[model samples]
Target: MRRIGFLGCGKIGKALVRHIAEREDMAVEFIQDPGFINDIGVQCPVLAKADEAAFAGADLIVECATAQVLSENLELILAHCDLMMFSVTAFGDPDFERRAKALCGTYGRTIFIPHGAILGLDGIFDGGPVWRQVTVETVKSPSSLGRQDNRRSVVYEGPTREACVHFPRNVNVHAAVALAGIGFDRTISRIISDPEVSTNAHRISLSGDGISITLDISSYAAGAVTGAYTPYSACGSLDRALGNGAGLRFV
Candidate 1:
């Protein structure tokens, strides 16, 4: 993220500002957030939208916006530089994913998907071919899942592709899991809105003829949608993506 910029200035974006504030490199160049006003307590200027100058200087743009926002601005953003894509749920649509990949090629740009809140992506990518099935069950607070239910309930259950369409903001980890392992349609995703849970949790189960693995990860976050540890994860991902020579990197 050389002279980086941010597409959204929400919790994750603001937290990332603080995370990399002291770094000599990877300093914030511009922030594009419509609702953002008042001092952000950072040295960077806030823009409602980035123009040519802002995009020209920025080698990478970190998108903390919603899936819809990414889809809307995909071409314009890619035209300038690489993108650290957080709204990976946008790729749940097979056509959108294909178009995004094609655009990356056309513009000579890259898109890096950071390891968000969940863990074990490395294992999934490695074990995918031989594994017979992969399933992930994610449990989050009702509010986190954008629900107001008084009782715990299963909000979504089915293939990862459809789950992303239903819960674009919440079930991104499921999308990540699907992308890392099997394709979106092949991976099973279950999202439960549990009023009893205070944290966002994921229970991933993988099985094959000779190997079986179960992985669980949870995070008590500062915001409803993003996990507390995500800022650090993004920072690490930015470092990994920048260090790689060219094209996209999954970190």
Candidate 2:
């Protein structure tokens, strides 16, 4: 059985942990959340400090918290166990990304990034070096766009680097697409705030090597910045990470 630790008790964390707990092959060992209380209702030890002792027996740590948390407790967490990261926007920093990869290499621990709130990553990944251009257009409600507007608006446009900075938590799907298909600077991202749109939508367009691909996915919005399908996406990623011992693998 896999012993899993959680780094947040918020919406995505709670949802992911709950799903993991329901699985017979996994055990929720510890949770680190400063604002956590009994109200979280998960049967696990909660820690205020993310120290080595806190994650002593944890085989894996899933971070559903802010990118700040990833940067803050990275070394200590990596020293203890492999990590499943939901806050992948933190990798927008070249130094942090390089350092994290180096640390994972040094410690022989894997860092997993889920394809959250999007689809068709496998096709993009399989396309490889042939990719000429990848563009992602994300549309959400005004509230999710962090704006109070009555009309539709184009909130942001540029590379993934600036997009992540402007909408850190909201543009994780963009970062995932960039990491999977093209480099951050090369991947163009456009964020739209549509007052009439009731769902979160993503349009991924790629062109290269005599192939033109476009994938559009829409999911009901959970909040201004979150889609209902995100939790399920995280779970799917987790299932892929924990492979069957003898079954055919499909990823």
Candidate 3:
């Protein structure tokens, strides 16, 4: 059984905890959430600070927390165990990204970034150096975009790095797309606020050597800033990490 440690207990974290709790091959060792004082019904210890000593025994440390959580404990967490990152937008900072990658290499720990709220990643990744350009356009309601806009508007238009900074909570899909295809700088990210749209929609367009591909996915809202499909993606990523032997993996 894999002993898992949680770095956050928000929507995605809570969902992952519940999913892992039901599995026979995994156990939630400890959870680090500042607001969580009570058990919260999970059979695990909750800590205010996700220190290295607390997660020393964990087989994998899943970070469903913010980019700040990742930045603050980069060395400590990597020194402890492998990391499953949800806030992948943190890598937008070149310095931070380089440091984190170095730490993972030095510590012999893997950092896994899930395909959160997007599609066609396998194809995009496989497309390789041939990928000339990739663009991700995300449409969401104003409320979900974490702002108040009365009419349809383009909230942001720039590289994935800047987009992640402006809309960290909303545009992780862009970060995932950036990582899967061309890097943060070359990858374009556009965020639209449309009052007409009830569900969150993501469109990824890629132009490569011999192929031009586009994929559109719409996810119903579970929260103002989150979709119902995100938790399942996170769980699927975890399942692959845990492994089930010789089965064909789906990227």
CA displacement after TM-score superposition, residue 198 of candidate 3 (Å): 2.4
Which one wins by lDDT: 1 or 2?
Answer: 2
Candidate 2 TM-score, true structure as reference: 0.93
Instruction: Tell me, by TM-score, which candidate is best.
Output: 3
Q: After superposition, how far is residue 121 of candidate 3 from its true place, in Å?
A: 1.5
lDDT of 2 by residue, 1-251 (tens): 99888888676777777788678888888888889766647888888867788676888888988898888989888888889898878988888899898999888888988777877777788785889999999989888877887888888999998898888888888888888888789999999988888899999999998999999999898445678888888887877877633567668
Give me the runs in candidate 1 sitting further than 4 Å from their true place: 37-39, 244-251
Q: Rank the candidates by lDDT, best first.
A: 3, 2, 1
Residue range 138-246, candidate 3, lDDT tens digits:
9999889877788999989889999988988888888888887789999999999988888889989899778888899998883367787888888888888777446
Model 2, CA-based lDDT: 0.84
Give the Cα error of residue 55 in candidate 2, in Å.
2.3
Relative to the true structure, how large is the alpha-carbon lDDT of every model?
0.83, 0.84, 0.84
* lDDT for 192 (candidate 3): 96
| Weakest lDDT window of 10 consecutive positions for candidate 2 | 241-250
